[model samples]
Target: MNRISGLPRMLAVAIIGALSITALAQSNPYDKFRNREYSNKGYLSEADELKLAEQVHQELLKQFRLVEDRSLNNYINSLGQRIARRSQRPNLPWRFYVVDDKSINAFATLGGRVYVHTGLLAATRSEAQLASVLGHEIGHIVGRHGLENVKRSQKYGTLAGIATVAGAILGGQTGAGIGELAGNMIAGGYLMKHSRDAEREADFLGLYNLRDAGYNTGGMVEMFEILQRVSQSSPNALGSILASHPPASERAANTRREISEHLRGSDQRGERDSSEFERVKPSAPASSKPPRKVRPRN
Candidate 1:
């Protein structure tokens, strides 16, 4: 009778242990994506993700010259925030900045930080196009792509390289050298090169954000078309964006498919242009300075 009671206790212990292991796996969040295509949650807590993004933001500030025009920055911020309000993580401290760089690039870090280069702004023709770009970047933040990459790197034991660099920046070790390395990784898309699936997910989410925010979803397709034209005519101007993203044509096709299937009436009813965007448009031309080549990394 004692042996039988002991077996029951052992079985209970094994069940508890299995449940504990399952709970731990669930905590990482990405484990659920094995059968699914996308997820918004990453391995890091909200506070820790914000902290990491703050570190990256500081590093980025050191590397890029921000557009000092209050109006331009404000307009971009307002537009980004508008779209961000429709995202999965609506309450994040969403912030947008215009980089003076002439490369047609826009990227989002882990937190709500999104940076748009002047060249990207200039490349777009209408408010919807520009909003589409902002929406896409916001989608990346909503998806927590950067943090997901961080979690993935940690799992593969490769996160230490950048984590150490971030620590050195916070700890003020080696000063500019360490900070610059992190900034370069960011610029080169090494630290934030989200997978193609993540790109598709961002596009999917961005379309909804655009439509929900009362902007035309067709602008997403137009954005891709603009990128395609830029790639063919002035490849150097779009090198960084093209390098890190899926082919513009492919993205355009996918966007078209998504629109046809789920958003058939969206473009017909949404705002496609704005007088304010035209006012801000002239200031968005590429800077005279050559763009810093952002080497793409997978």
Candidate 2:
């Protein structure tokens, strides 16, 4: 009777072990793509991606002169929050920072941090125009453009060196010499190219976010047109924005087509442009120097 009882207990333990293994397998998000072509390429565990983003965020804070104007910061945050609420990752801890530089630029990181140069804000004429730029950056984050590019690099086995540089950037122990190296690494190459599909998707999503946030979608077209004109006059002037993405004329055209065809005759009255926007514009810093070569890290 004792032996027979022990046999049933052993059987129960075996069944439990099997279920545990199955659960572990099912819980892995990347398992489904393990055998796929790009599965192994650029395969950063979600944990790594978040870690990289946090490290990059810290680096950004340390390297750039972050704006300290409370009202301006709050205003940008409010606009970002409204747009984020309409984004796919609404629950993310999104942050908006105003860079003190005068370059007309904006960028987004993987973990929902968006940086906008003061110059860009100064150049914009209205809240909707600003929203168009923010919407584009938001599009990059929502579309996971950086991750896709990293994956492509991984697929080609070219990401290992890049990942090493990224690791060094994140580790924060690199001395001044290596700091320059890492900065050069980030600003020198095409490590963060968003695919054409990703670009188009962001364009559409940006317009959607702008409209949802009660801004005029036409502002999207206008912003791109401004960028296009700037690019043609001196591509160097819009260095980071133009290089990381495609030509603004193409984007403007596409946006105009979408707005006309899809959102024809939409109401645009009563949209509130934050009063802070007006007050902050004149106070923003201007970049007197020419456009420097800065590689964009998505």
C-alpha RMSD between model 1 and the true structure: 14.6
Query: TM-score per candidate, in order?
Result: 0.77, 0.70
**Residue 173 lDDT in candidate 2:** 46
Lowest lDDT sum, 10 consecutive residues, model 2, at 31-40
On TM-score, the candidate that comes out on top is 1
lDDT of 1 by residue, 167-242 (tens): 5544646555554555655765665688887887777778888999999888889999989888888888884654
Model 2 misplacement above 4 A: 1-48, 161-185, 188-191, 267-272, 286-298
Off by over 4 Å in 1: 1-42, 162-188, 286-298
What is the Cα-based lDDT of residue 177 in candidate 2?
A: 44
Local distance difference test scores for all models: 0.76, 0.67
